[model samples]
Target: MAVVPVRLLLLIVGVVAQYVGITPPNVHPPNEQLREQRGLERSLDLVLVTLRILLWSWAFIEGSILFALSGYCPPAFARPFLHLPTNLTSDPTELTPAFLTGIVLTLAGALLRVSCYRALGKHFTFQLSIRPTHALVTDGVYGIIRHPSYTGFMMHTVGYLFCVLDRQGPIVSVCTGLLDGSGTGHTTVTRVWACVWATGLYLIYALMFGRMNKEDEMLQKNIGEEWRAWVKRVPYRLLPGVY
Candidate 1:
């Protein structure tokens, strides 16, 4: 069968998995509570969150642009080998077991990501600043992993890449594989560039987390030593025992 159907199938599987509790539940602080708080609800915090949202939105837009541009890109050297035989009837019967498996994985990944975002809600600001509304949430999904959302994000990215590869056939695999093989060459260089970009993103995230921790400390100073004890118990910021 066509790649689109395969992707859809995977997406459906993801949705099912999410409903079945395979994914973490939303655990971010409530928006109303954060808004009502005096320290975290500053005007500057709002602006920062807005800017972060815009930046992430731009990432989505850029992905769309790349997908559109792919139409014009020339086929890779291994295109012939990777190409699916078109002579087969374009019927549902053509849906291979592998394609179905891909569909399930993709769908599960997408659903997990969506659930994560929904759970994060207003707390999902992309800025490197902690607003007054910030709170140290450690219940729900947070109890299991400090940042289950990031885990979900990684899974979603993998699913996305799989979908793209499936749709584009083996040409993508050949090109990417070759690029991977040529050590420190152009492709490898590009991959490193991506890693640098990702590192920068993580650094920004770290800064934001640090800011939040500082805010938490400030609150503890006002609230008393009890808060500090709680922080000590948590240990990790993003990961559990590992971090």
Candidate 2:
């Protein structure tokens, strides 16, 4: 318990480090030019979209700190009617299994994203907008899938959620013996918060999926039958067997 705050601080630092480590400072344009380009509506500017995702990410982290550290929640907010567990602390052993797993997954995901960066070189942009001189990248890991970069980002998000859920919710307490747990993930209030949080995450995921489709459409249009042939060979978008 005494070290919990320190651990929490480290967790935040780790999150920032993940961003700093993976994203190349030079890759994204100084000013994205995504207005009404590549099938995207003018309203859906790349800057706006990036800002939206950043806001969501910040909210998720803040929510985790509140719900996990002190069980704080919104004013005038009501708990859910259904029952769930909420009083779980991160395990205190040298390395709790769930915590260890979370760290490993996060690190691995970071590596994957960095690999994607190296593979794409300057071709990678923060937005769906493609450069006129961009070549249809197919060799290397790109041949394995349509979007390794997205897969990397998805993996990082999943790992983050897993760590937060296991350490901060009662559903995972039994595995680590951190609390009484009540055999549930969260109490009504926490569940409600979680649902709201999950909904926000789902929206981001849907947005990313949309970006993937839009990018694919753009590629097929630009690259022609060669792109379609590569798609037939690769087949999967984010996952191997499942979507």
- Top lDDT hit: 2
* Candidate 2 C-alpha lDDT tens digits along 46-92: 53456346535753554353344332334333243112233334432
lDDT of 1 by residue, 75-161 (tens): 563254334333321221233344455455655555655655566565554332344564555566655655555555445434433
CA deviation > 4 Å runs, candidate 2: 1-13, 21-94, 167-186
- Once fitted onto the true fold, the runs of candidate 1 whose alpha carbons sit more than 4 angstroms away are 1-3, 8-137, 144-203, 206-209
Clashing pairs in 2: 84-186, 85-186, 85-187
> How close is every model to the real structure, measured as TM-score?
0.39, 0.64
Cα deviation of 172, candidate 2, in Å: 12
